[model samples]
Target: MLTRKQHELIRFIQTRLEESGVSPSFEEMKEALDLKSKSGVHRLISALEERGFIRRLPNRARALEVLKQPEDISAGKTAVRAAANSNTALTALKPALAAPREPANDVIELPLHGRIAAGVPIEALEGQATLPVPAALLGPGEHYALEVSGDSMIEAGILDGDFALIRRTNTARDGEIVVALVRGEEATLKYLRHEKGMVWLDPANSAYEPQIYRDSEVEVQGKLAGLLRRYH
Candidate 1:
Protein backbone atom coordinates (compact mmCIF):
# COMPACT_ATOMS: atom_id res chain seq x y z
CA MET A 1 0.00 0.00 0.00
CA LEU A 2 1.27 3.50 -0.89
CA THR A 3 1.49 6.27 1.68
CA ARG A 4 -0.76 9.30 1.36
CA LYS A 5 2.02 11.49 -0.02
CA GLN A 6 3.11 8.81 -2.49
CA HIS A 7 -0.44 8.31 -3.73
CA GLU A 8 -0.99 12.06 -4.13
CA LEU A 9 2.29 12.56 -5.99
CA ILE A 10 1.54 9.78 -8.47
CA ARG A 11 -1.95 11.07 -9.12
CA PHE A 12 -0.69 14.61 -9.67
CA ILE A 13 2.01 13.41 -12.07
CA GLN A 14 -0.52 11.36 -14.00
CA THR A 15 -2.94 14.25 -14.33
CA ARG A 16 -0.29 16.67 -15.56
CA LEU A 17 0.99 14.14 -18.11
CA GLU A 18 -2.51 13.58 -19.42
CA GLU A 19 -3.03 17.31 -19.86
CA SER A 20 0.36 18.46 -21.20
CA GLY A 21 2.45 15.31 -21.87
CA VAL A 22 5.07 16.74 -19.53
CA SER A 23 5.60 15.48 -16.02
CA PRO A 24 5.77 18.19 -13.39
CA SER A 25 9.10 19.27 -11.98
CA PHE A 26 10.23 18.36 -8.47
CA GLU A 27 9.60 21.91 -7.33
CA GLU A 28 6.02 21.67 -8.53
CA MET A 29 5.57 18.31 -6.83
CA LYS A 30 6.89 19.80 -3.61
CA GLU A 31 4.42 22.68 -3.83
CA ALA A 32 1.49 20.47 -4.77
CA LEU A 33 2.09 18.08 -1.86
CA ASP A 34 2.71 21.00 0.51
CA LEU A 35 6.07 19.53 1.40
CA LYS A 36 8.56 21.86 3.04
CA SER A 37 11.52 20.85 0.88
CA LYS A 38 12.48 19.24 -2.43
CA SER A 39 14.20 16.49 -0.44
CA GLY A 40 10.83 15.38 0.85
CA VAL A 41 9.55 15.23 -2.70
CA HIS A 42 12.59 13.21 -3.70
CA ARG A 43 11.95 10.66 -0.98
CA LEU A 44 8.30 10.28 -1.95
CA ILE A 45 9.19 9.82 -5.60
CA SER A 46 11.85 7.29 -4.73
CA ALA A 47 9.41 5.33 -2.56
CA LEU A 48 6.87 5.31 -5.39
CA GLU A 49 9.50 4.06 -7.80
CA GLU A 50 10.53 1.29 -5.45
CA ARG A 51 6.93 0.15 -5.20
CA GLY A 52 6.62 -0.11 -8.98
CA PHE A 53 4.18 2.78 -9.09
CA ILE A 54 6.38 5.06 -11.21
CA ARG A 55 9.53 5.06 -13.29
CA ARG A 56 11.93 7.67 -14.54
CA LEU A 57 13.31 8.30 -18.01
CA PRO A 58 17.00 8.66 -18.79
CA ASN A 59 18.57 11.96 -19.74
CA ARG A 60 15.33 13.88 -19.38
CA ALA A 61 14.09 16.51 -17.00
CA ARG A 62 10.68 16.05 -15.31
CA ALA A 63 10.13 12.77 -17.11
CA LEU A 64 8.13 10.49 -14.84
CA GLU A 65 5.77 7.68 -15.83
CA VAL A 66 2.97 6.55 -13.56
CA LEU A 67 2.66 2.80 -13.66
CA LYS A 68 -0.27 2.41 -11.32
CA GLN A 69 -2.60 4.44 -9.16
CA PRO A 70 -3.73 3.50 -5.67
CA GLU A 71 -7.42 2.84 -4.96
CA ASP A 72 -7.42 5.56 -2.35
CA ILE A 73 -10.35 7.63 -3.53
CA SER A 74 -13.03 4.96 -3.23
CA ALA A 75 -11.48 3.45 -0.15
CA GLY A 76 -11.17 6.77 1.57
CA LYS A 77 -14.72 7.66 0.66
CA THR A 78 -16.01 4.37 2.06
CA ALA A 79 -14.06 4.89 5.27
CA VAL A 80 -15.40 8.42 5.66
CA ARG A 81 -18.92 7.23 5.03
CA ALA A 82 -18.59 4.47 7.61
CA ALA A 83 -17.32 6.93 10.22
CA ALA A 84 -19.95 9.52 9.38
CA ASN A 85 -22.69 6.87 9.63
CA SER A 86 -21.43 5.90 13.09
CA ASN A 87 -21.49 9.49 14.39
CA THR A 88 -24.76 11.41 13.98
CA ALA A 89 -23.60 14.54 15.86
CA LEU A 90 -20.47 14.98 13.70
CA THR A 91 -22.45 14.52 10.47
CA ALA A 92 -25.00 17.12 11.67
CA LEU A 93 -22.16 19.61 12.20
CA LYS A 94 -20.29 18.79 8.98
CA PRO A 95 -22.26 21.10 6.74
CA ALA A 96 -21.63 24.07 9.02
CA LEU A 97 -17.90 23.30 9.16
CA ALA A 98 -17.41 23.40 5.40
CA ALA A 99 -15.69 26.48 4.05
CA PRO A 100 -17.88 28.89 2.09
CA ARG A 101 -17.10 29.36 -1.56
CA GLU A 102 -16.68 32.71 -3.26
CA PRO A 103 -19.65 34.38 -4.95
CA ALA A 104 -19.94 33.55 -8.64
CA ASN A 105 -21.26 36.80 -10.10
CA ASP A 106 -18.46 39.18 -9.15
CA VAL A 107 -16.23 40.69 -11.86
CA ILE A 108 -12.87 42.39 -11.65
CA GLU A 109 -11.01 44.45 -14.22
CA LEU A 110 -7.35 43.59 -14.79
CA PRO A 111 -4.72 45.62 -16.58
CA LEU A 112 -4.37 44.48 -20.18
CA HIS A 113 -0.72 44.65 -21.03
CA GLY A 114 -0.11 44.28 -24.77
CA ARG A 115 0.56 40.98 -26.53
CA ILE A 116 3.16 38.50 -25.30
CA ALA A 117 4.85 36.16 -27.74
CA ALA A 118 4.45 32.43 -27.17
CA GLY A 119 7.14 31.45 -29.71
CA VAL A 120 9.86 34.04 -29.27
CA PRO A 121 10.71 36.83 -26.87
CA ILE A 122 9.12 40.11 -27.92
CA GLU A 123 8.54 43.51 -26.44
CA ALA A 124 5.44 43.39 -24.25
CA LEU A 125 3.34 46.43 -24.91
CA GLU A 126 2.49 48.52 -21.88
CA GLY A 127 -0.87 50.27 -21.98
CA GLN A 128 -3.60 51.72 -19.83
CA ALA A 129 -6.25 49.26 -21.03
CA THR A 130 -8.01 46.83 -18.73
CA LEU A 131 -10.00 43.65 -19.25
CA PRO A 132 -12.99 42.80 -17.11
CA VAL A 133 -12.72 39.22 -15.84
CA PRO A 134 -15.09 37.01 -13.94
CA ALA A 135 -14.00 36.95 -10.31
CA ALA A 136 -14.35 33.17 -10.14
CA LEU A 137 -11.63 32.80 -12.75
CA LEU A 138 -9.03 34.37 -10.49
CA GLY A 139 -7.87 33.58 -6.98
CA PRO A 140 -6.49 36.07 -4.45
CA GLY A 141 -3.59 38.03 -5.94
CA GLU A 142 -2.68 40.89 -8.26
CA HIS A 143 -3.38 39.87 -11.86
CA TYR A 144 -3.14 41.16 -15.43
CA ALA A 145 -3.98 39.99 -18.95
CA LEU A 146 -1.91 39.69 -22.10
CA GLU A 147 -2.93 38.67 -25.60
CA VAL A 148 -0.97 35.64 -26.81
CA SER A 149 0.94 36.12 -30.11
CA GLY A 150 2.34 32.76 -31.23
CA ASP A 151 1.70 29.00 -31.47
CA SER A 152 4.62 27.69 -29.47
CA MET A 153 2.38 26.96 -26.48
CA ILE A 154 -0.45 25.41 -28.54
CA GLU A 155 0.17 21.92 -27.25
CA ALA A 156 -0.56 23.22 -23.79
CA GLY A 157 -3.93 24.55 -25.03
CA ILE A 158 -2.65 28.12 -25.10
CA LEU A 159 -3.43 29.46 -28.58
CA ASP A 160 -2.63 32.65 -30.36
CA GLY A 161 -5.24 35.34 -29.63
CA ASP A 162 -6.03 33.84 -26.24
CA PHE A 163 -5.85 36.16 -23.26
CA ALA A 164 -3.23 34.91 -20.83
CA LEU A 165 -4.06 35.82 -17.26
CA ILE A 166 -0.94 36.40 -15.21
CA ARG A 167 -0.35 36.78 -11.48
CA ARG A 168 2.15 39.47 -10.53
CA THR A 169 5.24 37.86 -8.96
CA ASN A 170 8.98 37.99 -9.36
CA THR A 171 9.59 34.34 -8.47
CA ALA A 172 8.47 31.03 -10.03
CA ARG A 173 9.18 27.34 -9.60
CA ASP A 174 10.20 24.98 -12.36
CA GLY A 175 7.67 23.78 -14.98
CA GLU A 176 5.35 26.74 -14.42
CA ILE A 177 4.28 29.03 -17.25
CA VAL A 178 5.44 32.58 -16.64
CA VAL A 179 5.99 35.96 -18.21
CA ALA A 180 9.78 36.24 -18.40
CA LEU A 181 11.44 39.53 -19.19
CA VAL A 182 14.50 38.74 -21.27
CA ARG A 183 17.44 41.00 -20.53
CA GLY A 184 14.90 43.52 -19.19
CA GLU A 185 13.90 44.33 -22.79
CA GLU A 186 11.66 41.60 -24.23
CA ALA A 187 9.20 39.22 -22.62
CA THR A 188 7.69 35.85 -23.52
CA LEU A 189 5.33 33.32 -21.98
CA LYS A 190 6.89 29.90 -21.59
CA TYR A 191 7.66 27.12 -19.14
CA LEU A 192 10.31 28.38 -16.70
CA ARG A 193 13.16 26.10 -15.70
CA HIS A 194 16.39 26.49 -13.76
CA GLU A 195 19.26 24.10 -14.34
CA LYS A 196 23.01 24.42 -13.93
CA GLY A 197 22.83 28.15 -13.27
CA MET A 198 20.93 28.71 -16.55
CA VAL A 199 17.35 29.72 -17.11
CA TRP A 200 15.64 27.56 -19.73
CA LEU A 201 12.48 28.80 -21.40
CA ASP A 202 10.67 25.77 -22.75
CA PRO A 203 7.82 25.79 -25.26
CA ALA A 204 4.87 23.41 -25.16
CA ASN A 205 4.93 22.54 -28.84
CA SER A 206 7.69 20.21 -29.96
CA ALA A 207 8.50 22.17 -33.11
CA TYR A 208 10.25 24.93 -31.24
CA GLU A 209 13.56 24.48 -29.46
CA PRO A 210 14.01 25.47 -25.84
CA GLN A 211 15.63 28.84 -25.22
CA ILE A 212 18.61 28.89 -22.87
CA TYR A 213 20.00 31.99 -21.21
CA ARG A 214 22.14 33.13 -18.36
CA ASP A 215 20.11 33.17 -15.13
CA SER A 216 20.62 36.93 -14.95
CA GLU A 217 19.20 37.49 -18.45
CA VAL A 218 15.77 36.23 -17.48
CA GLU A 219 13.58 37.93 -14.90
CA VAL A 220 10.25 36.41 -13.95
CA GLN A 221 7.57 39.09 -14.08
CA GLY A 222 4.53 36.93 -13.39
CA LYS A 223 3.18 33.41 -13.31
CA LEU A 224 0.36 32.07 -15.49
CA ALA A 225 -2.83 32.21 -13.48
CA GLY A 226 -5.31 31.16 -16.14
CA LEU A 227 -6.32 31.74 -19.78
CA LEU A 228 -9.26 33.48 -21.45
CA ARG A 229 -10.06 32.56 -25.04
CA ARG A 230 -12.34 34.84 -27.06
CA TYR A 231 -14.20 33.11 -29.86
CA HIS A 232 -14.25 35.15 -33.01
Candidate 2:
Protein backbone atom coordinates (compact mmCIF):
# COMPACT_ATOMS: atom_id res chain seq x y z
CA MET A 1 0.00 0.00 0.00
CA LEU A 2 1.16 3.51 -0.76
CA THR A 3 1.73 6.08 1.93
CA ARG A 4 -0.84 8.88 2.45
CA LYS A 5 1.39 11.51 0.90
CA GLN A 6 2.20 9.30 -2.06
CA HIS A 7 -1.48 8.70 -2.73
CA GLU A 8 -2.26 12.38 -2.39
CA LEU A 9 0.55 13.40 -4.75
CA ILE A 10 -0.42 10.89 -7.40
CA ARG A 11 -4.04 11.99 -7.25
CA PHE A 12 -3.01 15.62 -7.46
CA ILE A 13 -0.77 14.94 -10.45
CA GLN A 14 -3.51 13.02 -12.22
CA THR A 15 -6.04 15.76 -11.52
CA ARG A 16 -3.72 18.43 -12.85
CA LEU A 17 -2.92 16.47 -16.02
CA GLU A 18 -6.61 15.88 -16.59
CA GLU A 19 -7.65 19.48 -15.96
CA SER A 20 -4.90 21.34 -17.70
CA GLY A 21 -2.59 19.59 -20.24
CA VAL A 22 0.45 20.33 -18.11
CA SER A 23 1.93 18.80 -15.01
CA PRO A 24 2.14 20.83 -11.85
CA SER A 25 5.55 22.27 -11.10
CA PHE A 26 7.52 21.40 -7.97
CA GLU A 27 6.50 24.71 -6.46
CA GLU A 28 2.82 24.16 -7.20
CA MET A 29 2.93 20.65 -5.80
CA LYS A 30 4.71 21.83 -2.69
CA GLU A 31 2.18 24.58 -2.11
CA ALA A 32 -0.81 22.35 -2.72
CA LEU A 33 0.44 19.55 -0.47
CA ASP A 34 1.41 21.97 2.29
CA LEU A 35 4.96 20.69 2.25
CA LYS A 36 7.79 22.68 3.73
CA SER A 37 10.10 22.34 0.73
CA LYS A 38 10.26 21.02 -2.84
CA SER A 39 12.47 18.17 -1.67
CA GLY A 40 9.43 16.63 0.06
CA VAL A 41 7.50 16.73 -3.20
CA HIS A 42 10.46 15.20 -5.01
CA ARG A 43 10.61 12.32 -2.58
CA LEU A 44 6.90 11.66 -2.92
CA ILE A 45 7.10 11.70 -6.71
CA SER A 46 10.10 9.38 -6.64
CA ALA A 47 8.23 6.95 -4.47
CA LEU A 48 5.25 7.01 -6.81
CA GLU A 49 7.52 6.49 -9.81
CA GLU A 50 9.29 3.60 -8.16
CA ARG A 51 5.92 1.99 -7.51
CA GLY A 52 4.91 2.16 -11.22
CA PHE A 53 2.27 4.82 -10.71
CA ILE A 54 3.90 7.54 -12.85
CA ARG A 55 6.79 8.10 -15.22
CA ARG A 56 8.61 11.21 -16.37
CA LEU A 57 9.01 11.99 -20.04
CA PRO A 58 12.57 12.16 -21.29
CA ASN A 59 13.93 15.53 -22.45
CA ARG A 60 10.70 17.28 -21.55
CA ALA A 61 10.44 19.96 -18.94
CA ARG A 62 7.99 19.21 -16.12
CA ALA A 63 6.44 16.39 -18.10
CA LEU A 64 4.97 13.53 -16.08
CA GLU A 65 2.76 10.75 -17.38
CA VAL A 66 0.56 8.68 -15.07
CA LEU A 67 0.81 4.98 -15.84
CA LYS A 68 -1.70 3.35 -13.52
CA GLN A 69 -3.79 4.09 -10.49
CA PRO A 70 -3.87 2.33 -7.17
CA GLU A 71 -5.65 -0.97 -7.47
CA ASP A 72 -8.48 -2.10 -5.22
CA ILE A 73 -10.05 -5.52 -4.87
CA SER A 74 -13.59 -5.22 -6.20
CA ALA A 75 -16.63 -6.53 -4.38
CA GLY A 76 -16.95 -9.38 -6.85
CA LYS A 77 -13.29 -10.29 -6.34
CA THR A 78 -13.80 -10.10 -2.62
CA ALA A 79 -16.77 -12.43 -2.92
CA VAL A 80 -14.55 -14.92 -4.74
CA ARG A 81 -11.95 -14.65 -2.01
CA ALA A 82 -14.62 -15.18 0.68
CA ALA A 83 -15.48 -18.55 -0.86
CA ALA A 84 -12.16 -19.98 0.43
CA ASN A 85 -11.35 -17.45 3.15
CA SER A 86 -12.23 -17.03 6.79
CA ASN A 87 -15.23 -14.98 8.04
CA THR A 88 -12.87 -12.68 9.90
CA ALA A 89 -11.03 -11.71 6.69
CA LEU A 90 -14.30 -11.33 4.76
CA THR A 91 -15.62 -9.01 7.45
CA ALA A 92 -12.44 -6.98 7.35
CA LEU A 93 -12.71 -6.53 3.58
CA LYS A 94 -16.41 -5.57 3.58
CA PRO A 95 -15.87 -1.86 3.94
CA ALA A 96 -13.38 -1.64 1.08
CA LEU A 97 -15.46 -3.82 -1.19
CA ALA A 98 -18.47 -1.58 -0.73
CA ALA A 99 -16.76 1.56 -1.97
CA PRO A 100 -17.49 2.58 -5.57
CA ARG A 101 -14.65 2.52 -8.05
CA GLU A 102 -13.52 5.77 -9.54
CA PRO A 103 -13.87 6.03 -13.29
CA ALA A 104 -10.68 5.99 -15.32
CA ASN A 105 -9.50 9.27 -16.75
CA ASP A 106 -7.51 9.66 -19.98
CA VAL A 107 -4.80 11.86 -21.37
CA ILE A 108 -4.58 12.78 -25.07
CA GLU A 109 -1.54 13.90 -26.97
CA LEU A 110 -2.21 16.73 -29.43
CA PRO A 111 0.04 17.63 -32.32
CA LEU A 112 2.30 20.45 -31.19
CA HIS A 113 2.64 22.06 -34.58
CA GLY A 114 4.60 25.15 -33.60
CA ARG A 115 4.19 28.71 -32.37
CA ILE A 116 1.50 31.12 -33.62
CA ALA A 117 1.90 34.85 -33.38
CA ALA A 118 -0.58 36.81 -31.29
CA GLY A 119 0.83 40.22 -32.20
CA VAL A 120 2.05 40.62 -35.76
CA PRO A 121 1.64 37.88 -38.30
CA ILE A 122 4.56 35.49 -38.16
CA GLU A 123 5.57 32.45 -40.10
CA ALA A 124 3.94 29.45 -38.43
CA LEU A 125 6.60 26.80 -38.18
CA GLU A 126 5.63 23.19 -38.66
CA GLY A 127 7.26 20.70 -36.30
CA GLN A 128 6.88 17.07 -35.33
CA ALA A 129 6.31 17.45 -31.59
CA THR A 130 3.22 16.62 -29.56
CA LEU A 131 1.69 17.99 -26.38
CA PRO A 132 0.10 15.64 -23.85
CA VAL A 133 -3.34 17.10 -23.27
CA PRO A 134 -6.23 15.87 -21.19
CA ALA A 135 -9.08 14.18 -23.02
CA ALA A 136 -11.41 16.53 -21.15
CA LEU A 137 -9.84 19.59 -22.77
CA LEU A 138 -10.95 18.68 -26.27
CA GLY A 139 -14.32 18.05 -27.84
CA PRO A 140 -15.52 16.14 -30.91
CA GLY A 141 -12.91 17.25 -33.39
CA GLU A 142 -9.22 17.17 -34.24
CA HIS A 143 -6.98 19.40 -32.13
CA TYR A 144 -3.47 20.80 -31.99
CA ALA A 145 -1.35 23.08 -29.80
CA LEU A 146 0.52 26.31 -30.50
CA GLU A 147 2.69 28.26 -28.14
CA VAL A 148 1.58 31.88 -28.02
CA SER A 149 4.45 34.16 -29.04
CA GLY A 150 3.08 37.66 -28.39
CA ASP A 151 0.78 39.62 -26.10
CA SER A 152 -1.76 40.88 -28.63
CA MET A 153 -4.42 38.64 -27.14
CA ILE A 154 -3.60 39.40 -23.51
CA GLU A 155 -6.97 41.05 -22.95
CA ALA A 156 -8.60 37.83 -24.08
CA GLY A 157 -6.80 36.09 -21.18
CA ILE A 158 -4.31 34.51 -23.60
CA LEU A 159 -0.84 35.45 -22.54
CA ASP A 160 2.63 35.08 -23.93
CA GLY A 161 4.11 31.60 -23.33
CA ASP A 162 0.67 30.03 -22.91
CA PHE A 163 -0.18 26.93 -24.90
CA ALA A 164 -3.11 27.66 -27.18
CA LEU A 165 -5.26 24.62 -27.79
CA ILE A 166 -6.63 24.67 -31.31
CA ARG A 167 -9.62 22.74 -32.50
CA ARG A 168 -9.08 21.95 -36.15
CA THR A 169 -11.67 23.71 -38.32
CA ASN A 170 -11.73 25.55 -41.57
CA THR A 171 -14.64 27.68 -40.38
CA ALA A 172 -15.36 30.11 -37.55
CA ARG A 173 -18.07 32.54 -36.48
CA ASP A 174 -17.73 36.28 -36.38
CA GLY A 175 -15.77 37.71 -33.40
CA GLU A 176 -14.25 34.34 -32.49
CA ILE A 177 -10.55 33.97 -31.97
CA VAL A 178 -9.02 31.85 -34.68
CA VAL A 179 -5.73 30.74 -36.10
CA ALA A 180 -5.68 32.49 -39.44
CA LEU A 181 -3.11 31.85 -42.11
CA VAL A 182 -2.33 35.03 -44.03
CA ARG A 183 -1.53 34.85 -47.74
CA GLY A 184 -0.79 31.17 -47.27
CA GLU A 185 2.55 32.01 -45.73
CA GLU A 186 2.12 33.33 -42.17
CA ALA A 187 -0.31 32.58 -39.36
CA THR A 188 -1.70 34.67 -36.52
CA LEU A 189 -4.07 34.38 -33.55
CA LYS A 190 -6.76 37.04 -33.51
CA TYR A 191 -10.47 37.70 -33.58
CA LEU A 192 -11.98 37.03 -37.01
CA ARG A 193 -14.45 39.47 -38.52
CA HIS A 194 -15.83 39.68 -42.04
CA GLU A 195 -17.07 43.04 -43.30
CA LYS A 196 -18.20 44.02 -46.77
CA GLY A 197 -16.11 41.41 -48.59
CA MET A 198 -13.03 42.15 -46.47
CA VAL A 199 -11.45 40.11 -43.65
CA TRP A 200 -10.31 41.88 -40.49
CA LEU A 201 -7.98 40.43 -37.85
CA ASP A 202 -8.62 42.29 -34.61
CA PRO A 203 -6.37 42.17 -31.60
CA ALA A 204 -7.58 42.01 -28.03
CA ASN A 205 -5.06 44.62 -26.97
CA SER A 206 -5.78 48.13 -28.16
CA ALA A 207 -2.10 48.85 -28.59
CA TYR A 208 -2.09 46.92 -31.85
CA GLU A 209 -4.02 48.03 -34.91
CA PRO A 210 -6.50 45.79 -36.66
CA GLN A 211 -5.23 44.06 -39.78
CA ILE A 212 -7.47 44.16 -42.82
CA TYR A 213 -7.12 41.89 -45.81
CA ARG A 214 -9.02 40.74 -48.84
CA ASP A 215 -11.25 37.73 -48.37
CA SER A 216 -8.90 35.65 -50.51
CA GLU A 217 -5.89 36.50 -48.35
CA VAL A 218 -6.84 34.61 -45.21
CA GLU A 219 -7.82 31.05 -44.40
CA VAL A 220 -9.24 29.80 -41.10
CA GLN A 221 -7.08 27.03 -39.75
CA GLY A 222 -8.63 26.40 -36.35
CA LYS A 223 -10.61 27.83 -33.44
CA LEU A 224 -9.15 28.62 -30.06
CA ALA A 225 -10.31 25.90 -27.67
CA GLY A 226 -8.29 26.27 -24.44
CA LEU A 227 -4.97 27.23 -22.90
CA LEU A 228 -2.24 25.64 -20.76
CA ARG A 229 0.21 27.68 -18.77
CA ARG A 230 3.40 26.58 -17.03
CA TYR A 231 4.69 28.14 -13.86
CA HIS A 232 8.19 29.51 -14.16
Best by lDDT: 1
- Model 2 TM-score (2 dp): 0.56
Q: Which sections of candidate 2 miss by over 4 Å?
A: 1-104
RMSD of each: 13.0, 14.9
lDDT of 1 by residue, 143-191 (tens): 8989899999876657788778787999988988889999988999999
**lDDT string, candidate 2, 1-232, tens digits:** 9888887787787666544435788999999899999999989988888987778755556777666667641222111111111222211111111222321134576888888999999986488998765454345578898988999987665678877878899999887789999999999999999988999999978899999999999999998766766544
Give Cα distance to truth, residue 43, candidate 2, Å: 42
> What local lDDT does model 2 show for residue 107?
54
Residue 88: error of model 1 in Å? 47
TM-score of 1: 0.60
